[model samples]
Target chain A: MNKKSMYGRTARKIGCYAALLILAVIFMFPLYWFFLNSFKSYEQLFQFPPKFWVWPFRLVNYLEAYMYPAFDFGQMMKNSAIITITSVIGAVLSSSVVAFGFSRIRWRGRDQVFVLVILTMIIPTEIVLTPLYLIYSKLGLLNTWFPVIAPFFFAKPFYTFMLRQSMMGIPVEMDESAIVDGCNVWQRFTHIILPQVKPTVLAVVIMAMQDQWNNYLEPLIFINSNSKQTISVGLTFFSGMNATEWNLVFAGAVMVALPILIIFVFFQKYFIQGVVVSGVKG
Target chain B: MKKYTVKEKRAIRQGLLFISPWLAGVIGFTLIPLLLAFGISLTDYNFLTKPRFVGLENYITMFAKDPLIWKSLGITFLYAIISVPLQLVFGFLLANLLNQKLKGIVAFRTLFYAPCLVAVVSSTLLWKQMLETEFGIINYLLGLIGIGKVSWLGQTGTIIASVVFISLWQSGKMIIINLSGLQAIPTAYYEAADLDGCSRWRQVFYITLPMMSPTIFMNLLIGLIGAFKTFTQIKILTDGGPSNASLVYMLYIYKTAFTNYKLGYANAMSILLFVIVGILTVFVFRTSNKWVHYGSE
Candidate 1:
């Protein structure tokens, strides 16, 4: 390469690296801010030149956030756990079963129904919010977890598509062999098919967990009672008119966001693989 | 294999049985709600009162009478158009950079992706603090640069800009998706370009650009759809304030339905949005064939 071209390449490379690093810092700083702010006392939080580090690190905010008005953190965590676990179970089981029908079965109008399922992806959920609210209210399911959890029992489109793609990758000969062994479809599903797509199933579980744990709008609109409120909604109370307490709010946010962050960090390889696998198929 | 009647019936039965739960849920939760929403669009239904047939009055009023409806729709369009292209371009650039070999690349990628994983509500709240006029960090930084404190959220122009900023930041996920697509391109293309004495810009033009088109197309469509439906950020950040400059279509529809108790009007607005989004999506999908290059024929 000519000296000028070499210089140009070096400049470009340096430029690219610097830009990415800067953007990354900008993206990450707010999250870092929340963590650091959660530990700082009220006066320290507003200090000019912004105290990057503070001594005598305080656990008081977190504890106070937990203990304030009977510190419903444990209960809220339990609620999130229950919702996430059940939703994941429901989403995986139902989507897989539905996916089997879509991918493997040759029933009449199956393609049509599958198209209908895909159609749901394009429409905004807000459009249906009112009608759904009416229906849920009429069914006496409002203020209960039923509205939140019932959708999972029905296959979500994304999950259904994910499992269907995974199932399609399995050879038809496997089903043929199972049939030759005089195994029923259910037995084949349990012994052969389910095990083959265990990773995809785990992917579905993790996704469903993340979605439900962070779910805010649905619970906000649907659940009215404090007792039924999920952690997402529970944390919203901190930002209410009178209190507007930054310290406690950051603590609550940290509490709300930590579990999913930890889960993502630990299982990111699986999650990224899952995303790529699903995306490539789609 | 013996094609026995009973066996065929049993397999079909099992298939239906297995899929029955999903079928039930789709119809119950999704299809029924959609249909009811369509039906409600024709009536004067609020939550409290029984739905009375209005026969397109809601839609007529929305289009012909309600000026706010148009303004909000305009805002939604603005938000989608402004943010989607910026996201695609920025995301593409980021993905291209990250596609290179670098030290601590994994850590850098993870750091970039972390903002996406943070709960949006929490992130919005943080942005709220950072943008606070008097004591916010952003303005504080601005003060050093000899710029006076600008009300980021309180003003019309700044509020929309702040919402756009939040949307742009959230584009990191799509950037990762783009990165994956970029990496999927084979090395042979670049090698061939090099052998042809192709310049960097030309190689990107002839090879990377065409190969990544399908992913770009997908991202664009998804981004457009996602942006049009944006509510959480608008709700948290500005609440569609300062003379409704930042009021998005969904937030408008939401207020119409829940706050104003105008379900019929809301449904009409929704149906209008639904049609607009659908038309745009189909247009993109149809035109995608022209621009998007798939690996397989």
Candidate 2:
């Protein structure tokens, strides 16, 4: 409680808060700037000292982006909604079920197979792109949502691994007692194991939704037809156009990014927890 | 083969049955395609015609004929080497700062992480405007400081740096990971250090770091792997501009497949890319024992 050390401690705390506040602004500025600029007029955008305040919120660029016949932001939204919703469902369901089998069930070679799954996670998906393209084409699934949606129905290694870790943490007695009581494997999975790993399940849902919603590469590669394409590719075309409408591009970006941003804001706890679990126990 | 108890047999049956979807996926998606990818690499296939066997030609073309492969590979490595270390070290530093007991720390963490949640396309689009050669905000800001316009995404001299700049704010993921790792360490360690008269820096080096080594090493491995696959933002911002100076390896493989209709050669390049990634991953794993500390008491 000496004055000198106390003052030094206060000074350090102040400096810490100041540094964090400054860094937060630096980190958040691009997103803030992007949102603000989306509301500016072309004249406002072109001005030397760019407008910071979003006075008189501009709706024209948003409308123009939406009605811009080629891009069709509405259809893209529907496509993304379908893909994200279905992919989330598939990822959560499959990852949970597979993790149960891998974790709760004792089988010969299970550990080895689980190790293989984790190892394969390191292989970049690009390595499989060319051959998968051919396979999809031969299956006549190109220009269809099937290719985009089918992969998630299988246990993605990372999600499966994470869920398995959580599932394994539950005391063995819970599931074993259920098993002795004539609770079948499926019953054990659904009634006992699944309920225990609900938080991880929520985590899986967030990640799967995030992955599919922001997914640009797979959709671009798989879906060739204009009508079937997702929002990311449509927005890419807007930005890539030589004579770009900066306002419209910003507006389009806002449209693509806003939904997930809202979701992230609400479920910030789960998102942080999800990542922590993945890292700490991973 | 050894016989199993009926109960054990039932358990094995249930496990396999439950993971059947994944097993099916391995055959339908991964196994078949991967085996076929190796097969395709030894041929000359375009979408239009049959794959004519051209044994080792694509591999030769990759190593000997295509100089861009080496250049793009070098560029990708440079990108990974630059971006990933920043992601790890900066993320750890920021995490340590945020780990301090403070008011409204959650809000600060969220704000820092918001950029990472933005759609890659949107984030890239935002940056493309901010870095546009003419009428760019960055250049406009620079004018106040008496610096000339520096064509960030245009010139070869600064293209990688420009791409690296956009990626800087995205260390949010690493920050979160590091923060969690930091939080997981027992507070008793720090308390003990204080009781022993350890300086703040000494406590960090002696207590926090050794405890956090495994987590930091995980971030390094994941960051490097993710860095090598960086494509979408660069594709949107520059599209390998200024005569392909910014072309990362995946972008090259993509173009080689879709644009040039060299499916066979593209598949070959992809396998090589995988080999490179595998080697790097193994290399990191091998080095982990030298630094990464396992669980403590």
Best by DockQ: 2
Tens digits of per-residue lDDT, candidate 2, B1-297, equal 899999888878988988887788777777778888899999999999999999999999889998999989988998887888877778889999978888887787778778878778888888877776667788888888998888898765587787777777766666876887898788998989878978999998998888899788867877888888888877887888768888999999999998999999999998898788889989998998898888842
List each candidate's DockQ score: 0.47, 0.62
The list of candidate 2 runs beyond 4 A from truth reads: A1-9, A176-182, A239-242, A277-282, B1-9
Local distance difference test, per candidate?
A: 0.79, 0.83
Q: Give the TM-score of candidate 2.
A: 0.94
Best by lDDT: 2
Query: Model 1, residue A192: displacement in angstroms?
Result: 3.8
> Which 10-residue span in candidate 2 chain B carries the lowest summed lDDT?
B154-163
Residue-wise lDDT of candidate 1 within A1-282, one digit each (tens)? Answer: 689879987888788789878987888888788788789787776677667788887779998788668337668778878998899889988898888888776565577777676667666676778889998898898888988887887888778877886787789999899989998777888897888887678668877887788787788788887777888777767754564777787788888889888987887667655654544323
Quote the TM-score that chain A achieves in each candidate. Answer: 0.87, 0.91
Error of 2 at B6 (Å): 4.5
